[model samples]
Target: MKKSYCPIDTFINVVKGKRKATIILHLFQGDKRYNELAKLLPDISERMLTKQLKELEEDGIIDRKAYPEVPPRVEYSLTDLGKEIHPYLKGMFRGGILFEKRIDESL
Candidate 1:
């Protein structure tokens, strides 16, 4: 089947996945290394994390910088466009917390 990459669906494509948003949410705190990101989001496979990072970089939502050292180091952080979405992400997080509380209360 052919997948449609519509303009309206582009944002969802980038931000609506488990690993993708998890990566973005954590990085809101600061830059993160590959292993640090993997540890922070332990459920994600390293391959998935790598793929998501590349996608985000291609979309200009995140920047990856590699430093030369004995073992080499790479860190990922939000780009200006990514920072623009942080407020929305914060609100989403707050809303999710409230929704979970409501579910707990009902249970």
Candidate 2:
């Protein structure tokens, strides 16, 4: 992760990539194979999903395991660091809902 003057900036730096936070949130529920993640995040292009997963792995937020098989088996799970950040991310999720509700009400 990139060093920053503020802790929040450092946190943001790790999760700034496309769908990074969403991927973490999904993984927080349980370990998931690559195809399952792809299905969960249909809006993201395959290339972008691959890129984000790689970045999250590099950041030590997720663990990637591969198994030797005919088709290849790979699973992704959150690391301790990733689990540690879940509460904070969940708070952000709740905050987003609040804002979205306000926006809907305003319309």
Candidate 3:
């Protein structure tokens, strides 16, 4: 991740990708396979999901383990850094809910 003067900017830069935060949230629940994540996030295209996962791995937020099997199995789980950021992400999730509620109420 690029260094930023503000810590918040650094944090935002780490997760600034389509469904990246959502993917982390799901992985926070437990280790998940590629297909499991795909099911959890139906709106994201396979290509986008793959890209996001690769980026997250590169950023040291998530670990991808590949198992040698007939079809090849891969699982994703949060790294120590990823777990450390959970509360912050959770707070953002809550804030998003609040804004969404306001939007719905206004409509």
Candidate 4:
């Protein structure tokens, strides 16, 4: 199948969005519950977080599992592919930090 523009850019777009990568980083530790993620990412709204998580799961970057119980339970974890792309995400974060450092130094 033919792809539009740079495939690499498209791949990045899939996982890149406001607070999305940070969510992924948190998941890198292990599977996390809905409340756990919300607690970890307090800056993000519940609606936005829900949307981003659904998108990530759709993109195969993460998996959502629910267990039948009284209170209900759901957990999110990085799919194998998410782990594979995490190194690249780490590099991106490092580069961003460098850029911020450079700007601060110049100022």
lDDT against the true structure, per candidate, is 0.84, 0.95, 0.97, 0.90
Give lDDT: candidate 1, residue 75.
93
- In candidate 2, how many Å is residue 81 off? 0.6
The TM-score, computed over Cα atoms with residue i paired to residue i, of candidate 4 is 0.91
**Model 2 residue 21 distance off true place after TM-score fit, in angstroms:** 1.0
Number of the candidate with higher lDDT, 1 or 4: 4
Q: List the residue pairs that clash in candidate 1.
A: none
Error of 2 at 11 (Å): 0.7
Candidate 1 ranges beyond 4 A from true positions: 1-9
Following a full C-alpha superposition, what root-mean-square deviation does model 4 have from the true structure?
Answer: 2.0
Model 4 regions lying over 4 Å from their true place: 1-3
TM value for model 1: 0.81
Candidate ordering by TM-score (highest first):
3, 2, 4, 1
Cα TM-score per model: 0.81, 0.96, 0.97, 0.91
Residues 1-107, model 1: lDDT tens digits? 12347854666666876578778888888999999999998888888889889988888889999999869999999999888888877887899899999999999
